[model samples]
Target chain A: MTPPDRRRRALLLAGLSVAGLPLAAWALKPVRERPRLIIVGGGFGGAACARQLRYLMPAADITLVEPRAQFFTGPSTNAALASVCAEGDIVRGPAALEALGIRWIREAATALDPVARRLRLASGTVLDADRVVLSPGVAMRWDRIAGLDATTSERMPHAWLGDAQVSRLRERIESLRDGATIAISAPANPYRCPPGPYERASLLAWRLSARRLKRCKILLLDAKDDFTKRALFQVGWDTLYPGMVEWVPHAKGGEVLEVDARRNTLRLQNGSRLRVDLASVVPPQRAADIAVAGDLVDESGWCPVNPASFESTRHAGIHVIGDACIAQPMPKSAFSANSQAKLVALAIAAQFAGGPAPVPRLVNTCYSLLAPDYGISVGGLYGVVSDRLSTLNDGMSPLGAARELRAREAAYAHEWYEQITRDTFG
Target chain B: MHRLAVLALACLLLATPTTRAQDSLSLSCAVCHGARNAPSTVPSFYGMSTAQIESALRDFRSGAREGTAMPRLAKAMSDDEIRALAYEFGAPVR
Candidate 1:
């Protein structure tokens, strides 16, 4: 037999004792030989899956492959950019997962072979597993925008991924002179954190106001005509910072055509040019390169999956979650990713237990901070309907809620960050 | 011998109903309510009676109790799901 066939035979033998062997002998084998599971990426989805799987299957061999030692969460990076929290506050390391007996490989996953259930690392090492769960988040489509490749991205940071780009944009905002014009380019639908750009605009305006910089203008150039929680966000903006922020929607020439990074100028779709002191352009996005290289993504540039199991429709024995997968009616937020990861973990655990997949009931709640003391939230419960994930019930925070209610939500938002980060990282 | 082994494994899963219930819907509660003894603003129902838990959820669903997100979340759950969740999470801490 060939080498791979031999390996498969050996694994099968290891998984089940010989047909005539005594049941006692089969039961006595070390539990460590039970199964091998590998998880890619260490963000909310990946880490939460690792933690939940470790809880459900104590003896399964679990390994997490993440190149970065520290992970900066995208959920609260807006607060850090607005100076409400320090940049260090949003950072978490894998030491907690390591302490829980999870093996952490600090190397990039260069490629994946879905049929073989094997992953190749940057150091030319191949890791094979019984199952692989990928949560490699979104990657910016730099080619879609002119004059906004990797080099120009440094000068005009998108700050979408909660990396050094956040600090780059923060520095620009801090150094702005009074009456300076700051332009923020919002991307079209199906991006990470739908309410993120609006929240960023609100917090940055608060920051500028705190600095007592009078007449500073924030131009919110949105590519889409409508946004999530539009009326609520507009009401908050009007109440908090009157005449300081202007939102230009797609119909009003809000679509960004190109950027002259050197001159700090943006060319809108209506053939109008606006020069600004600082520009934060959030570009369109797609699944990360690893998914594309593995042939996991379809024509839509996002991975399609069986919503019940989150197992890739393109490949068996591999599941894709988080921003990389198309889970409609569930916005790509940290809460949604965490929810999807838990369901995936339980589905895998059910498989190991020799039971049918559990009926899936997913939930998500996203909290956006308008100011440090003001917050709004949108929440939903989802289930599979007609083979698609559909929202069962959903609602957003009430419009014109009392000040005390908004403040309570603000406190709950902070507590949510703390609890979610702890639950995921630990 | 393989058939006998499979039979024994099947017998071992006698409590599969409760395990299945615990594995699905209740797992989502940890994102906010969190595990027992963890610091969270959301209330924990670890030691509460299952009846109490069920009543609260029903109240939220019926609009008898006002909440920021719970009412909407509770509306999605059926009576059976509510009982499963309450029984799973409301079991007294051993």
Candidate 2:
């Protein structure tokens, strides 16, 4: 037999005890039971958690529920807009996950029943498992903005979730006239990616510049007065796109109160209106609808989870991670989801093995590319202290960094994108 | 008498804000390096001595050790915090 077959045979033998096997051989085998781990929402958090559990608990059955067959990472989607990376390059499918022995349920999770330890799917399938991990990410609060809903989203795509929206947004930007003006409206705090809007603006400006649409302008209307890596992004805008990009803060009538898709006009909170050729409205967000339906969220609209294991504080036998849960001091980003999910998987594995769960310290790094070779980042380490997740150390890219330093950081960003995607998907 | 005095000193040190901050920082290092059995591409601190971890962290903080995300991360921490991490990672596993 081949080496792999031999190894598999050995593992199978190791897992089962012969009826009349030697006592020593029986003692050498693992005595603990392998529990079923069902992970809902196969994005960064769910996918990465499934991958890690496959490695940590080889005997355990792992299942991942994601509605979509493919996932496009938010990290490199901005680069996709600039045509630096193709839409397919940012996409992840179930092939790598299935290869890891993870059962993929291509259906949206409709309800989670903690009492019964089962999840109800929209397809009328019920999944029962020893432990359930929820990483349902966020849901757009379309009601927060006037004239914004599922149907209208097609006209003015947020392009935040999947490749389809991103592709539509890219096509719209690519078709802009030379003197056209585009507006990107940023959502309030506690959004999925803090620097996402700024990065989108930068990439759009880069595309316009490359097309030599000097008369084309990009307007960034932010709900907050300041943003993540504000200084670095501002400097990059001045140096690279220069006069092509403009930022209006909340105090300066930048908070979008209403959007008129037909006329492509946005009314601000300060009672001001601006008519633009294109508008990308990123509305307010909250925990995924499933979390709320599962009664896992509190008044804050995010799930409260134990920091050590990311187990839901509201429901036993269920753990929450990624953007759906409160991992304060850790931004709601892909890297944070991947890191937090791995720790949750480890803790779950420990529970099944009849051992104490390892207290994990989690790390997160969020990088934004201002130009093809100009990048900025913010990173930190977080740990559970006295049962709360607390920040230990954090830092951002230095303000006014040298051009060479920015260039190196940009290269590191691409490398990080490759490594993190592999880590999560594989 | 001397043992009591040493115990008192240790308790007092642990209660200090500076020492507490260092403890927090040291625990954060474990996020990336603490898992021994898990599959990871990053380096581990499981079996290293305090001096070895300290020397390496100092180099990273000062840009002596280049590449990856360590230098910038270390620069965010202080010398005392780095030493604290060394002690935590270097502690003999019970």
Candidate 3:
């Protein structure tokens, strides 16, 4: 056994013996065995939770169930679209979890019985745990958008979920002609990364401008009238891209009602239709399928979690974090997921120890790149007030900040990306 | 080195249950300043006197010091909480 594991075992044995528990309690009771923690999903939320749990509760048996061999972070994928960084830069092997003594089960979770504390894997293996953490970031709602399905994704890549789709979208942008038009459809609220579509549009405009494709323009169709950091993005687009971008809000023929992938056309809710050379459709999203299958989600398509402990209100002993849970005032970003993961880790430890979980004051900072060096950010500190997630104090980058401040924010964004990845994956 | 790393990591990871006034404020301060995993790069709250940390927080809460997030976080913290955090994080790492 590793040194840490040995120390944990010693501590457990000592505690059991010092309590003077009966033989039945120590030997006969199955629940009294080392508390097993099954973490579903290995994205930022799952991976970071696993590592933190292993660190804080060494005696707990932690197993992470993730289907993917590597995690591709969507936080900085816009930089990849602009060719500022290679697609590989955002992808990382999740094998580092083993260093923290976390057992990784490379399989998809098919079923979860919260009442029985049982989880079933795709390979037909059933594992029981004392507590389970559901961190399956998000499941793309393909059914919400008509004429859009997995097959349609080949032509009109959403590129919002994984690395492969992101590369496909980049390829579509690269092959565009000088006069070719590209359109991006932004989804409704409560999706992963609120400002992501705008960031992608800004970066694509930068690339098209750099290539001197003056006639090629980007058409951003939004499902919402206003977006997170809309003013900041508008200022950046006007200053940097000039007349190369057009944004249409939902009230003005922006909400996409249907997509004719065969003709590369979009039918908006406002009775408008347009054909484009390339289309990036970000559909409405919901919690992962496993969360839904376990009956953990509500009619809102998101899981309601107690902001203090992130415990699913629908079920007990199942804590949901990251994008899967509704942590309002906390955007579904990598930083928020990491912050929430830490909170979940501690709450679980306190739960098993029969101690009260302290209220967490979480923070989230989201950065968007206007150029390679020019960036803007919006951030806030979140805490629980009267059972709802409340923003203590929040602000965004001044729209009129100097170029140097934007550059510094851009650098800080990169630094944050590096730090969060290390904290999560390593 | 390992012990220091563990302490830093612990500061970041697990939130100590707040039994006293200072403990609660220290946990809040750890949110942005540093923690077991996402340690702060701004400045070390460790190895400082309670007086020093308290002065900084008071200045931030009152806008005596120019800042952004700190001022708001400090504003939410009571004077007693700030004094408690000062003493909590002030002790030198063993």
Candidate 4:
């Protein structure tokens, strides 16, 4: 071979090796090279945030912590009890998370050490991360109700979260024969699932109307002067099972003072004793004793958060969202919690990127199943105001329209649920 | 050549204003609500009452109104922006 030919071959080989260098480095690079983000509760909020995180910032690592293997969203959960919708319709798997490379811890978080930025899990494994999100939904304040606790919930079934308690209430509805008087006792504001009790009543009515339409009446006792979707609930009641549901607002001594779940009776603030075949009880709610015990909540039993980022006011690097956080104008719904999760995720991303948090756009929609084909919904947008969340005016459709409108809304309501479930765990 | 193309793309991105996050969103209000014949879907904001804006903001903020992404975007705007945007959006063009 000539000298020039050998020299050209050597230069070609050097160029080829230089080209292969980047490919070798890329092949050897680790998958989890980016920053790690740990999100608690893979329900609407956590899951949505995780999903949106992929769109906004795909390079970050997100780990979602949830005790449940599958998520059952509340958006369409009310329809399950009413027989208007099926439970499977609301249940969604981890396909959405898997797409975004979101790792999962299949257990609840027992404790959080914000200072160390470590999340202690129930399985004794520890998750140490750059950011920790706690969206552990809301728990009942049993102390507010003199005789009710977690055990009592087993019998009465808040059924707000649509789990074991939800099925328990449905079973009770099935067992009760004609002319059975069922009482739905509701807790005060900031409770998880604000429209849950009414939705349960609607479903129970759906069951009753199937067999004995006019024979049974479900009395809904409330602690608020008026309630979420009151007009919608009223319209549905009027159309589906007229005179079958009685709604007592808070002003009329509707605030629950005591409950005897064993006997299926309610003791109101007044000296009134009401006996019923089945009583579904929703006790007052505060932050989970976990956050409160850990000094996460303020005096109001809720963790105050900067609505924009959902970051803890008392602690940095820790974000609180879902029903446990104080969102004044935003109702403590699963949708609201899910939206807050995305905002928090962005805020965490901004922090990781060493930049100020980009203001977020949050959305929420609540659908109620009034009858088999009747549904009503209210959806809105949310914003951060003075370190808290407030709703934009006229963002939601007024609930409880005319009979025809209610039924039409119900059809749309099912679609809304399916869309939200996809947004969460789809 | 690839590196130069990448550099060119980056420069283009740098050249394009990243549109101010919030306050600047109002700049487009003129495009929609300004002098041109407003589309049917576009509601007239010119000469709109403040009470009307407050009412509208309340609806957008809370999800009482439906069918648009306005609530989420409107909620993010400060009350002052809502007021200012309302006034500016409502102002009659000279």
Candidate 5:
């Protein structure tokens, strides 16, 4: 054990003694046994919760179950697609979490028994925890989009999740001829990253402009009539990429019914065909398979949790955060996940101390880049009202702001990404 | 045992007398401002006095100061909450 661990254990023992617990009774229990906290999924929510739990309860046996050795953040994947930054810039390794004594389990959790507080790994090893945090993120619902399954996704990459799919889309964008048509089909509401499709379109426009591909047409086919940051993105598009991009809302037959990857065509709900050189279709999503298998999800296909502690209402000891849970009024963004993770950490700490979880004040801020140097942002504060999360105060970047202010916000956007990733992963 | 007792006493002395609400509220700030050692374009509140934090927040809340996100965030905080945040984060770093 490290010296800090020794010190913390001593403090804990001393506190227990002060509470009039007999030394003999303390000795009866295993001296080395500490609180076991198992966090499944090592994305923003899981990783951030692990780091915070380490700070709050230094001696807890915390194991993070993640299959990947390295994590790539979704925030900047659009920039990577636009070639604004290299793919390596967004990659983070688990060394920092490891240095804090967090056990990194490089394996997938095959099953979860919330009632028993046990998890079964793909390797057939069962681990027990006092409390479990499931931040499994989202799993794409391939069945929602016809002809768009795992195999077809190879041809029409979503590139929504931050992975090699981003590279795939980037390659397709790079290989496009001057007059090639690109179709990007966005999903309906309650999806991860509300402003992501718009940001993706903006960044793609920026890239095409840089490559001097003036005649290339970019079609933004949306399932929803409106999107987050619509005004800001439309203004940015009009000013930056006029006549280069077209956005078709659902009312205007923008909802895609089927995608024929072989023909490079999307059949719209209105029975119109859109033949394009490349197609990026983002399908509807639900909680990951593990959460569904654990019976944590409600009828909405997302887990419902007590707003104060994020404890699953369906199951007692398991807390769900991130995209896997239904946290309305809070978009499923990285910032929201990070905020939820911290609150869950505090809730768990309070539980360990035999106190009720404190009422949490959650905050989220998301910045979208229209260009490398132009940005817009939306931020909100949330608190529980009548057993539901409600927005307290929120605002977005002022429309028609001066160019200089937008530039400043753009710089701050990069800074926010850097600090948030460092805080969570470290 | 004597050394352990001394350590315990020191730990108590070092612990700040802040409520759970304040601790939870201050955590949101770290998402942007970050820990003391982490470099950021956003200003760190490490060495700021309680008065300074209070003043800045009030100014931002009242539109006397200009910021991208802080103004909106400050508007959400009550005066009591602001004072609590100031007290929580205003401590000098050693």
Candidate 6:
């Protein structure tokens, strides 16, 4: 071909290519849209999910919707109950997510549209996606604690995972006379932080016994017969401050029937009531607001999810994890939430983008306070089987360890706390 | 022929990106420690107990340990990832 004619032809071809760009882009779009995975409630579960999703699927469109600007984990707040501090000590907001290029917002998820696959936020922002991972932590089940609503909670602190309520409770504890009794009522199962009430009681009793010579008492009213870490907690309680802490299980006169915050009195199911100085009723909880409104929960008021992927059974493309979902053989600790979140994130990445998820292994470690020097812990390595999680009982706790072993485990517990915080936060 | 060749190149460019790669790291303790997995001279993955591994990790993170690759490497990992690697290799039974 002639040089001039060829140059002219090349220019024409380039213009045609530029003109076809929009049409070609439109044609390349998938018939069914690329599934957008939306993670709700930016706690351990949501954060872990987003982090792993970013790592696994860099190109997949991922958006995380959490109401809170920052996250203060329950891990550190378990210690805040002893000291005179507020949420400021425990609350480290969601800067971790921003580092991973995950988008976050400070608004609650008000509603969910499962069929339409869109999550509606409190501020009227609609997040439409293919899969929604809901880990709204837990919401208070008002029925468990009578006469205690949001306003009543301010006076009678639940402080399930925050620092303020714990600080307020500590202040109440300190101002009271030595002979006065401080009451801690543990609401039903599935509260935000299970090991919290015992840790608080232990820390308070540690101070009370040291300062007041066994004058102050912590009457722990538990709804369940047993707790996360029982024998170790009891042993530490007995060794540190015997008779300073008295636990009343639900079988006893411990089931909290009613509460009058103004009077500082508690009524039990057995028709006996007592007046106390400090009242903390950790109420029963549900799956935030969105999970319930979305009809994702079973009759038990908790979301049932596939244990492996944490995918909600109620809704396809929706994965419920962390405290909101019913994770049996596992307490709703931050460690459990973070572990499950990573699994769900990987599962979704594989489902939508055809990658293999690593064989899922999970871990849960919870540390409780016994004079802070004597820490009590319960943990286990877990594996998913038959689509259910089974705790590897072999390597968890050396069953019925000696006192020295327990104390050493306690030290490891402290180390575990600091290490896990850095792991999740940084 | 040139137009046909350019069209062929465009099709190849549009293929899906499906290559998953993970950063793999391994320690060869033979020279410094000893070889053949036992590492009798220094320390092996199996030689260190759980408590020992946990202590090393804690010290590494805390800057308490003497300068070494194990301490330095342990410091860089998150508890999640540390436990993960520990879960993979720690408590190795001889």
Candidate 1 wrong stretches, greater than 4 Å: A1-33, B1-21, B91-94
lDDT score, residue A331, model 3?
Answer: 93
Q: Once model 2 is optimally superposed onto the true structure by TM-score, how far is the C-alpha of residue A320 displaced, in angstroms?
A: 0.8
Worst 10 residues of 6 chain A by lDDT: A24-33
Model 4 chain A: lowest-lDDT 10 consecutive positions: A23-32
Model 5 TM-score is 0.90
Best by DockQ: 5
DockQ for each model:
0.62, 0.09, 0.15, 0.06, 0.62, 0.06
Candidate 6 global CA lDDT score: 0.68
* Tens-place lDDT digits, model 5, residues A211-248: 99989999999889999888998999999999988999
Tens digits of per-residue lDDT for model 6, A344-406? 776776665534555565556565657656655565556666778776441223345566655
How high is the CA lDDT of each candidate model?
0.86, 0.80, 0.81, 0.69, 0.87, 0.68
Off by over 4 Å in 4: A1-33, A54-59, A93-96, A386-388, A395-404, B1-94
Q: Per-residue error at A264 for model 6, in Å? A: 0.5
lDDT, residue B56, model 5: 90
**Considering DockQ, which of the candidate structures 1 and 2 is the better prediction for this target?**
1
Which runs in model 3 stand beyond 4 Å of their true positions?
A: A1-33, B1-58, B67-94
Model 1, residue A246: distance off in Å is 1.2
Clashing pairs in 2: none
Ranking by TM-score: 1, 5, 3, 2, 4, 6
- For residues A170-218, write the lDDT of model 3, one tens digit per residue: 8888888799889998999899999999999998988988888979889
lDDT of 1 by residue, A1-426 (tens): 136755665666656665554444333232334678999988998999888888887888899998988856899888998899998999986668988889999998989999988899999999998889999999999887788888898888888886789888888888998899989889988899999999999998889999987699999998999999899889999988998889999999998889999999999988899999999999998999889988899998899999999999999889999999999989998888888888898888777665567788888899999899999999999999999999999999999799888888988899888888877886
| Per-model TM-score versus the true fold | 0.91, 0.81, 0.85, 0.76, 0.90, 0.75
Sort by DockQ, best first.
5, 1, 3, 2, 4, 6
